[model samples]
Target: MAMAIRYERPYSHSAHWARRLAWVGLVVFLAAALSHRFGPLTTPHFLVLAGSGAALSALAVVLSGIGFIRLWRVGARGGRAAFVALLLAALPLGVAGYAAYAYFTRPMIYDVTTDPFASPPWLKVPVAHQDFLARPPVTLQDREIQATAYPELTGRRYEGALDRVLEGVRKVADEQGIVFTGEAGLENVISDLEDLAVKPDGDTGGESAITVVPVPSARPLEEGFLPRIGGPSDVLLQGEWRSLVFGFRFDVSIRLREEEETALVDMRVASRYGPHDLGLGAAFAERYLKALDAQLLGIAGN
Candidate 1:
């Protein structure tokens, strides 16, 4: 009698869904990231969710990698899923790593002021009962940094009458969408001094036409990274580039002092908190000055 040949059935790979699990983890992480960026939840809550999701996704990636290697050895399936999952996992990982690097490498100061020598004073009266963020006093170190980083930020001189110079400043600020504060309007009050037989274009002790603009508030984010959003952000990076929450605000000011046939316009932008401005102050001043220069040229032509 001949014995029948016996063939054992091949076994399926254990944890074949490892890669699928990684995919799910990645999805969770992406959702968390979106929520952190655009969702109405506060910073702390967003950080927690993001941190948890990243951890889970990372673990899943590791497990999926191991599973893929094992499956290959065993001649099992799911090679494609494993590879795709690994690739997907890397996207957020790379982003997080880059953000960490940028955060760590960011400037030490959070406040940016245009006039480092004599920064225009910020006067936001504290709201009653509600704690208000106050503008940071300019420090020597901050001035030094501003001077070094923004050498071209010095005031520019223009030859024009007081009203004309003031109009130029106003137009520039308006174009930039900066609203003038009451203090800035006080320049109009001092415009009477122009009639003292004093030259409005000379530096013969004529009051400056000032324009104060409170920086616009940031919109509720729809989706984006921290640095990509509004200036003077409440999110601050501290030790090891960790998050330090501090609600803050920013404002910009233009002071145009009249001298004989010349007006010296100085711009100052500052945050209510932090010492480093991420170089935003310098950028704002540069743009404003350029716009003012163009506006004055237009006026001269007219």
Candidate 2:
């Protein structure tokens, strides 16, 4: 038996584009809603921000409603459907608008609380931590970032050739009163600078990459091991060199708090380099981390 087939050409290109637009708007809406729910749901700032978002959403919908009334005046039969879709699209507009407001309005005078381990799910593992994780992720500019390309960015801070990073770390541990400081754990270090690329230029550009090494590990996070999206990532090793390069990109950030609390955030560096740049990247990373880690260790100890 042959199956009957029917073809309808009722859907126009304009409608197709409209549907695509609706989907895009929906994605934006969902993302904004999730961020609002997860990022700052309980704070007073969040409430204020959400209120503004709701108001903006109402405004956009109201504008569309006015347009709908105008369409009805023109004798369009289904102005109602247009109004619904238009209002829905404007939902995300409110989200984006309010988020912008939150960006400029939130108070920067945050107080850090010391509740101990408020560890997120991504930070947990079935096995006990052989060592603390490498430095936690960071939010640089507007995005979460990590130093995975050069060792210097992620490694121990050094004052100069006379300074050893390990010694510096110990000194800081004593200063901060970090009592649990036997071997916090090892960090993944890197040596290549070429693989790190950002958006607006190559496959990714508008971003710059460099690495540092030798920083202590911090607590883990509640994120999943998502597949790399291609940027800069590091893998640690137990060889003459401490870190290895197994991936292209990594996202990292510092833990956020309402106040200034003691937080230990570790960092790492890694990369795949060419024949000529092995020393180039490693040396740069080492130098960078030496100085940077020195600053951090000072903080940790203090």
Candidate 3:
């Protein structure tokens, strides 16, 4: 009598674990990214979730590598699962790796300005309390690094009136999806100098004496009798910009000054929260300047 044949197929547990970890990691990464983008979670929380996901993904990669070794040596039945795990882990791992590369290669600065000597002041002040990272002030060394790394990020000088240049600036900003938050020096204040006149003094009797007096008008003049010479005429615009994919916040300040027949434009961009901007501030400033140049193509000057 012949005994009944028996057969058993063994599968690699490492491959199965790798697939499960990859799936879990991918889900966590997506949740973290979506929550951060939609404002449901703070940046610090998001970072924690993202880091956890990346760590899991890295572990999955290692497990998958081990699974492949086991399959070559012991002929495991779960090779397909290992391959799928590797593919699934690639997304989060690739993103984390690229971010690491940027952090290492790029300048470690978050703020950039066209005029480093006198950067444009922010019309919309940042909130005193931030949720996560507290951005540090841009130092002289940071400015030097920015200048060396991005020499082309310079101010623009256009041969146009303040009003015209302002219009172009607004248009470019709108096209670039910058949301205006605050503004200054955009309105014209009518001079009160014309409200004063030389009136004949009644106390002078028959003498031809005259005295300068304030003429009563509907609008009250500002305090002090002397007329102000060359008041603040520079225009400043502050806005908030966000990245298309990640929605990272950035604060932007644009200053326009009228000098003779030309208007000078300067911009300052700073990350809302982070020590390093990954070279995005300079890129944003350059893009804005180029768009403004295109807007006033014929009026751009050296």
Candidate 4:
């Protein structure tokens, strides 16, 4: 009698390593995202973790490809492991790919303003030390790029009083969940309103004495410059917004200028971190403006 022949199928070692790498990558990516969202990890730290996760995922994908080729050529087990590894790696790889695409295609600007020439001043300026990336200040070239890329992001003019427009702005901001961090120039509006209310009629001009009270001012005073007794020329409202998913903070400033009977509104938005906002600043500005337009419907002008 002839002896019976026996064979044992070999498993792809590449497939097993691919699966292990995919799981590790996925875990790292999740930890990074969640820590950034809810913990104390800074932007730089988060970026490092994310990059590491992406690199591991990419390696896993390469190993999975190799495993598939081997399985196709030579009969081998662990094909299921390779397939699962590929699936597991897809999430981080897809996100990294999308981010890369956006970085190349979109304007590499973290700040955007409706009026680039006279951008709204920040009431609470960003602290330089807090930024780990140390992005350079916005330049003239950046403004030009923004203008060309986002032509529709112009300031809004309304045929309404500054106070009325400001009320609408507050309402819209509240509706959109923007938290007011600081403000300036509102006292001037109040002073102007008081002056209008207490104006003397014609031929009733007389010397009037008014007592001034000193109070702590939020507005910064320039060296050798006297503090204004009257209100500022323009009202500035500074606020912050956070993304719902990632909780990424964004600084926002809205300037309201009273031009006779009209109110001109300009807005600026900037990401709290990163050199590239991926056009999110422009998108938020546009969304806020549209919401404001809807709130102030008939009074909106060019």
Candidate closest to the true structure, highest lDDT: 4
Candidate 2: deviation at residue 299, Å? 29
Q: Cα lDDT of all candidates, in order? A: 0.52, 0.33, 0.77, 0.78
For candidate 4, write residues 1-302 as lDDT tens digits.
99998997878999889999999999999899888888987667877898899999999989998898889988777799899999999988988898799889889999999876658888778763444676889997999999999988887776555676788899999998799989888864642333123334563546442322111112222357443221378899999987765567789999987755556788999988888887788988999988887887643221
Model 2 stretches astray by more than 4 angstroms: 1-20, 28-67, 107-302
lDDT of 2 by residue, 189-236 (tens): 322223222234353533544323323443344255542221122121
For residue 199, what is the lDDT in candidate 1?
30
Model 4: how far residue 243 lies from native, Å = 2.3
Model 1 per-residue lDDT tens digits across residues 1-302: 99999865333333345556556667766776665445554434544555565665676677677766667677556666667667766765665566467446555555444445455444442221212322354587877876776777676666555566676777777776566653443333233333323334655555644322211112222243322211221111111111222222345655655544455566666543344444554666688777877777765312
- Residue 280 lDDT in model 1? 50
Candidate 1 residue spans exceeding 4 A from truth: 1-106, 125-137, 185-249, 272-275
Q: After aligning candidate 2 to the native by TM-score, how far in Å is the CA of 159 from where it should be? A: 37
Q: Candidate 2: lDDT of 40?
A: 36
